[model samples]
Target: MKFLSFSILLMILHFTTYSQTIDTAGYIRGEMHSSDDSLVGYFKFDHTFGQNGQSVWYKKDLQTTKTKRFQTYKYDYFTSDSLYMELFEVMPYGFGEIRVMVPRVINGPIQLFYFPHSTPFAIIQPKNEPYLIKTANWKKRVSYRKFKRDMREVLGESSLVYKQIEQETLKYDDIPMIVRLANMNADESTIQDYIAHKKSAATSTN
Candidate 1:
C-alpha cells in the first residue's frame, strides 16, 4: 500500500512539471470579413510539439452569410511560433480565406520572415554581413517627396502601394526606410525610430 502511494505521487509530479510547459505556447487570433457585415472566416493560432509544420484553423460564419455548407478547415504548412507576426492577410481587402503567403529570405542557414498584412513590419539586422539590396536606391536620392513623385512618374502609383511591390524586396536597410515613408502604424519605439529616420532623410535631401 505504501509503495503504490509513492508511485502515484511520483507520476503526478512528473506530469505536473511537463504539462505546464506544454500548455504555455504563444499564438495570435484574427477574424476575416469581406465587409463590415459579411464575416467570412477567421484565422486561429495553433501549435504542435515534435511536429514538422504548423497549422491554422479557418472558420466561416454560417449565421451571417446564410450558408451552412462549410464549417472549418485546417491548413498545415506554416512553421513559426512565439515570434511577432506582423500581419497575416492583406489590408483594406481583409476578408475571405486566410491566405498564408509567407515569403522568406534565406542566406546560408538563417531565415527571416517579415511584413504581416495589418501588423507593423519588424526589421532585424545581423551584427555584420553582406545584405542583398534588391530595390532601387530611392532613399539615397533627393527625398521621400521626390521618390513618391518618381513612383507616380514610372509606376503611375501615387498612393501608398507598399504591399504590391514587397515581392521585389532585397535587403534589410530598405525595410525601415520604406516602412517609415509609408507611415504605417507600429510599436511606440519603432514609430519613434521611423520618425527619426524620416527627419534625417528629409534633412539629408535638403
Candidate 2:
C-alpha cells in the first residue's frame, strides 16, 4: 500500500512540475517561412515557457517541431499588419556574431531589424548585402564620421538614400525613414527582383 501511494505521489509531482515549467496554454497560430520568404509549413506557435520564450510549432497532424534557426514566423492574428519574426545574425560590441530571433521593423530594400536582446539594439541589412550593419553600439559607440561613411558605403552611390547620408542630413535615429526612402529608390528595385528570384527557386525546389 505504501509503494502504491508513493507511486501516485510521484505522478502528481511530475504533473505539477510540468504545469509550472511549460506554458502550453499560450499557443498561437502561425506559418513557418524559410529565409527566402518561402513557406516551409504551417503550425500552431508557442513557447516552451511563458514570456520571451523560444518558439515552438505544432502541426495539425500532431507532429511537433522547434523553431528553425534563421527562418521566420508569420503570426496569423496580425493579418492586416502582417508582422514577422526572423532569426538574424547579430554582431554586438565586444562579442562574436550570434544568432537571435528578432523582429523586422522595416521590410524594404534596406531592412531594419530591432534587437532588443542585446547591445547595438538595432541593425540593418541592405538588399544583397551579406552582413548586418550595427546602427549604434551604446558601449563602443558610433562616430558621426564613421556612420556617414558606412551608410554611404552600404547604400551605394547610386541609391537615393546615399545622398542624404552623404549630405549629413540623416542621423542614426532616422534609420527607419532612411530604410523607407531606400525602398523608394528606383535603383534599389533589385530587391524586388531578388524576391522574384527566390520565388522561382522555391517553385523549382517544390
RMSD of each: 19.3, 20.7
TM-score on alpha carbons, each prediction:
0.23, 0.43
lDDT of 1 by residue, 33-58 (tens): 22232233433443231112224444
lDDT tens digits by residue: candidate 2, 1-206:
33335335544543443332233363334454543443334433332222233454544333555444321223211111234545544433334443434444455546555432333334663222222333333212223346676666667686666665666555564454455556666354543443345456558889
- Model 2: residues with Cα > 4 Å off, grouped in runs: 1-25, 33-81, 91-96, 120-146, 186-206
Clash count, one per candidate: 2, 0
Q: How accurate is candidate 1 locally (lDDT)?
A: 0.32
TM-score of 1: 0.23
The alpha-carbon deviation from the true structure for residue 152 of candidate 1, after best TM-score superposition, in angstroms, is: 7.8
Candidate models: Cα lDDT each = 0.32, 0.43
